[model samples]
Target chain A: MKNFDVYVKKQLLEKYPSMVFFLVVMLFPHFGAKAFGLFFIMLFSLASDVRQKRLDLMTFLPLNRRQIFWMEYLFLCLLLSTTFFVGLPFAERSIYAWLVLVRSFIFFSSYFGVIISAVSIGFDPYGAAFLFLLVDLVLGGIGSSQLGPTFNPYKLISPVYQANLLASLVFALILIYMAYRLFTQRGGER
Target chain B: MIRVEHLRKQLGNKQVLSDVSFTVEPGTIFALIGPNGAGKTTTIRCLTGALQADGGQIELFGENYKNFSQIYLKERMAVVPEERHVFRNFTAKDYVQIWSRLYSKWDDTIFSNFVARYSFDLSQKVESYSIGMKTILFVGLCVASQADLLILDEPTQHLDPTVRLEIMDMLKECASSGRTILISSHEIFEIEEYATHFGIIKEGRVIYSDSIDNAKENHRIVDKGENLQASDVIGLVGSSVLVKTKSDVGRYPRLNEIVVGYLTGHHERSLSLR
Candidate 1:
């Protein structure tokens, strides 16, 4: 009945074990591990959908391509928000901790956006992940310098001043919007 | 109730559906027939909005499927897709309950009747079901939802002849009760039995569509010996002439003969729509 609700529930069940594993792993201060876990979950979800040819089953449903993309985006946002809440107290309410949270939110949103866009645009989950990894590595290499802090996608925790952090936040938001545009074009490829 | 015009779709390097066009009148059973890889399934996909068309229009219930919201379209239809597999996460009963709540016209009594007919246990997990049982459960759910339009792809594909016959009766009842049925089936004999209209598709195009009577009336089966030198020979299979120029034809042709005439021998020619 509630198609979106059912879809979210189904995805949650499919990835429950991995999610729990990531949640526990994030309890430690290692943001890189948690980020990798989150990315893995994203890739796994897309891979399963692609492998099973989910569209063949979904075509009979009333969902259009944009709706399908929105469902995926909703799922990603929910999972990310829930995990972030669970980790909120660990920072001990310091401004330093708030900065980490802000930066992580921006960084994760951008990564999620790109990954979903890649999968929606006909890349297999594996291919998308590897391509994203390659691009991030190249960008990090270019940005590495004392003059400008490197834009290392793998880094989750580090000191960031307000001005640059805000700029990064704006850039990440733009990427999220662009991913929406690309993901909306998905469907009918099946 | 259905009108399709110049629907086109390209997948990967191949154009899967091209310039396909047809219509299904209200309460009419339109059987979309074709050989494997002849685009019957693709046509069904485009019609159901599972796959979008690159070009063309699809109108149903006086609204274009391409431009209308999916919720508006779904409110009037129930579909049984080609995939017969049921999700292992839910029991058949769970799905029935979910759909019953989803559709405004769902009939619980009808749902119960179909479950009884199929002898399905709602308590059983879907993974425990055989392929045929899964299909029966899905079909039952679709039928009991009480939508006005039913779009089914290969609905009777995996069933035994007895069950297939039962389904034929069920669909006939649905049609006679005023539902518009669009079905794509390879069971030529089954289509011949119940379909009031027919459309034969090949390589992404609808080659022919007409009433069953009209299709039969327009084509003839000639003995190959008599039509060997005839320039109008449509096709020859073994010792039989599957099709030839219209005349006082030598013999009555079955629907299968007419279909084979298009698929086997007409591969190199442009679409010849009747």
Candidate 2:
């Protein structure tokens, strides 16, 4: 746990400037544009091991590949989701809007985090982004399928229903778990 | 403290590590040396678990590598990878603090002493330091971690002669404390002074490996003008031949000579005493 915390600090500190810039961008009213940029910047940040090519180095530290992967995801989620939830004032007034807001936050972050795990396992991030874009457009079902009436930031923002926040959270958690399982089984080799 | 057997890895179309094997007992400094592309880095990668080996076994501290807990193995070992392994944005202080907190064995006295010895401001960003300075900082922290085993690759590359000597002395001290050290370096002469064992690689295969004393005993450089014909004709001078003969009559080959001879000389000889 201590090692993971140190790793999180190092990862965030390494990309501090870009992270700060993205956070500032999130504060603007252009939620759609900001989120789009967020996808690239956040995913690029996922390449924490790419720059130093230190996947091997990290193995020498007191952290497993799974722990390292989890911390990175956690760092990105905490950093980006905080920005996301801060925009909740703009959410529409609907039945249990607060539940919807929290659910959507968990759901979208995990969804995209799973999508980026491929990049962590050797897939080029830009190429992964392109593939992700293709899949999201083609399947039209796995991600943000129903842009509910209460969607605030964008007409395409996947909105949560009344008390279904638990379901949404459960769904994303399952996907995240599966992603981590597959990642570790591969031995974290690029 | 370390054992590798028949480790093999194929990267894309090339066989980067083919049948590599070596063992390092506690308190020994083993130098892994080879020509460029000889798979020194690949071997280190496999041992560190950075790259999974396609075949063979590795045992660290008598624990089968596959069965050992990742955190347990990591806590007992530390590595200074090839190049650019530093967090550029972090100041020296930040880098040290991170490792200090992560490892229970971290020696604050050593860390502070190293910082003072290096005489660099801890507040400066790591990227702002020269490459040599970066090497000093990284090596200092790894030493401070006080791991049971230390694996370093090209650790002294950018360092000056003075710093390199200091670093080598520090590593020797580390080994004296019962720690094991595995180093891969091109600075053959420098390592020869401190390394107790050697694993010489040639085109991805381990050609020569043994305790430095045993290596010296098992291999010798026949005087160039010797009248004897030997099987391993490793090098040739103006009027003499360098032979890897086990003959007690010939002088022991230095580590540098053995490395060159294995990489370039022929291994065919018929003995004739001078």
Model number with the top TM-score:
1
In model 2 chain A, the worst 10-residue window by lDDT is A153-162
What is candidate 2's lDDT per residue for B1-274, written digit by digit as tens? Answer: 9999988888767989887888899999999999889999988877877667888899988888872245778788888887646665889889888888877899999988988888979999988898888878878888999989998888898988888888999999999989999999888888788899999887677777888787667666666556555446665533445565576556777777777766665442211111
lDDT of each: 0.71, 0.71
* Two-chain DockQ for model 2: 0.49
Candidate 1 lDDT over residue span A7-92, tens digit each: 67656655576567766665443356456656667666644574456655554665655666667767766776666667777756
User: Is model 2 an incorrect, acceptable, medium or high docking prediction?
Assistant: acceptable
DockQ of each: 0.40, 0.49
Error of 1 at B105 (Å): 2.4
Give TM-scores for every candidate, taking all chains together and pairing residue i with residue i: 0.86, 0.84
How does model 2 score by TM-score?
0.84
The regions of model 1 sitting more than 4 angstroms off are A26-34, A87-91, A95-101, A141-163, B224-233, B242-248, B267-274
